[model samples]
Target: MSNKPTCRWWPLAMLGAILAVVVLTWFFDGLKPELRLDMRSLPPGAGHWLGTDTLGRDVWLSILAGSQRSILVSIGAALIGGSIGVGFGSVAAFFGNDRLRFTLRAYLAALLLLVVFVYSIAVLWPTVSSTGHVSVGISILLALIAFVAIFWLLLRRFNLLRSRITFPLDTITQRFIEVISVIPRLYLIVAFAMIIPINMFTLIVLFAVTSWDVMARMVRAEMLKVREMTYIESARIIGLSESKVFFRHALPNAIGPVATQVCFTISGLLIAEATLSFIGVGVSPETVSWGSIIHGYLENLQAWWLAVFPGICIYLTVISLHALGNDLDRMCHSKH
Candidate 1:
């Protein structure tokens, strides 16, 4: 018999365990108040497997409740940020004039660099809870500028189309894209306006602003390259309107890179969250993340299990995402 341990089953096994933890936590959270952890009556005995935390609350329950926070933050941040980044980048790719595109590239590069610097500084002196309002404000502002830059680029593209030729409903469709683009961008601005002082939500906002551009830039580059392909050129030569060539031929091909970027981006964001939490700049102490969990165990290094569990979670998340991106890249190439 092969010595190999059916490694393929590992991911499924881990996922199953994670799912079980979630379900069990949900069940326990809904338990009768009296049935919950009663520190006075409990010890490291048969009933309590993991033992109680400092506050006499069940460590297991705390972990479960905290997972809800962590997952929600990650999902919310990814959706908000990913949408802005993808939508903005697509507009820039499809419609921008050379000048607008160049300007946008320069600005985004600068902003990304600035964010990197900020992240480094934040990492050096981590806090239990960062300035959520400030982080949210900065993120929203960055998103707005990025979105506007992208919209301007798309507008220029539409103008180019208008100068060359038009399609059926080109005017209406162009106008609609232009208008809808502005709406999402505006939401970013409004998000800044309605800022609350919640660290978890603010961190999500931060992640959304900083992360999406990488995906957007990748998508934009793919679109630019695809637009110059033989099919696109032929379409243009045959007097096909710009929108038709962009939407029908170019955009679809560009989606592969975008999808791959998003997969990677999600993984990156999770790591970023952990990093932020580790340094004390991410979620509040009230919440639990791999980073915060590790932070709690930092001094208590002897308690290896405390750090081990969270570290594993972080590593697995990153690895899974990297694997997902690689698979998507292969699939995309195979299709092409």
Candidate 2:
């Protein structure tokens, strides 16, 4: 029994560790460790605390340098995911029990299609204009195909609404959340990572896209509770606009759960990024991440420092984020 509180509180110390890592990484961001062929696979010593990797880059320095991108990607993904989840979840909460002409799945599909459209243009325009690649035509054609598919779905949705068909938005959202939850995130990662070049941008977009549904579910639940509160009603009765009411009052009350969800998302993303790097699917080969340092261990087991140090970084970071998330979740539940 005495150990319970100690176990619970110990993770708080990790908060300091995370802060230190962030600061260290930021300080060293512009200083990437160069390859030292003569010093390859050296063990930890005065010159190199974590030793050198197969490429002879200082392992400790590599971890610190790579950490900046990984940590930033996780935080960026969580922020973007949280924003999207809050928007969608709030909209669902507003129309909740009332039958709605629109469905979340349709909404999601349309939104995704629009993103694909815009992203494809941004990516292809340069190639088509300058390089004139045959692949650009194929990409443009594919984008058009995706647009047509979404248009068909929207057409059917229009027909249903025209027929006076309506659905309980809450039920639709819950079922949509379940479906999104079941679509194995790793599968999406593999599918996209294989097709698209994996970099900081792609990783952030991938992590953000896959992480939002759970957050949306949490936000929706919180919003439901907040909507029934006396203060929320008072705001509405005082002629405050719905958007202002939600942004000013409802979002604040509902933000706790979303905050907890973001921490969990970050924890999961850190592990995922490491796993991707381990499998050689992360950022470019030159990009030295903690996982990339650990990847060297597979080559030479004798270089144990290659794996151990970076592994410690990943493990400690994930643990810190997970523990923090658990604490936040507990606090939110207890207050509710």
Q: TM-score: which candidate is best?
A: 2
- lDDT for 18 in candidate 1 is 58
Candidate 2 differs from the real structure by a C-alpha RMSD in angstroms, to one decimal, of 6.2
Candidate 1 overall Cα lDDT vs. reference?
A: 0.57
Instruction: Assess the local accuracy of residue 168 in candidate 2 as a C-alpha lDDT between 0 and 100.
Output: 71
- The lDDT, on a scale of 0 to 1, for candidate 2 is 0.77
The per-candidate count of clashes, in order, stands at 4, 0
lDDT of 1 by residue, 1-336 (tens): 844322244544554565576566567756312224346223344554543332343444545555555555666777787687667666566665431223443444446666655653354213323443557556655675676567557656665323332222323333544554445432343343344334665567666765565666667677767766899789889998877877788777777766667667666667666666665553555556556655655645554555565677768766765666676676677666
Cα-based lDDT for every prediction? 0.57, 0.77
- Write candidate 2's Cα lDDT for 1-336 as tens digits: 432222266567776666677787777655578889899999999989889999989987798787877788888988998888888787789667662664555565556776776666456543453455758668776977777687767767666433443557777677877877788776787776555556787678878877889788878887888889999889999999878887899888887877678888888888778888887885666788877788899989999998888888888888887887787777777776
- Shift of residue 330 alpha carbon in model 2, Å: 4.0
What is the C-alpha RMSD, rounded to one decimal, of candidate 1? 11.3
TM-score of 1: 0.59
> For every candidate structure, what is the RMSD over all alpha carbons to the true structure, in angstroms?
11.3, 6.2
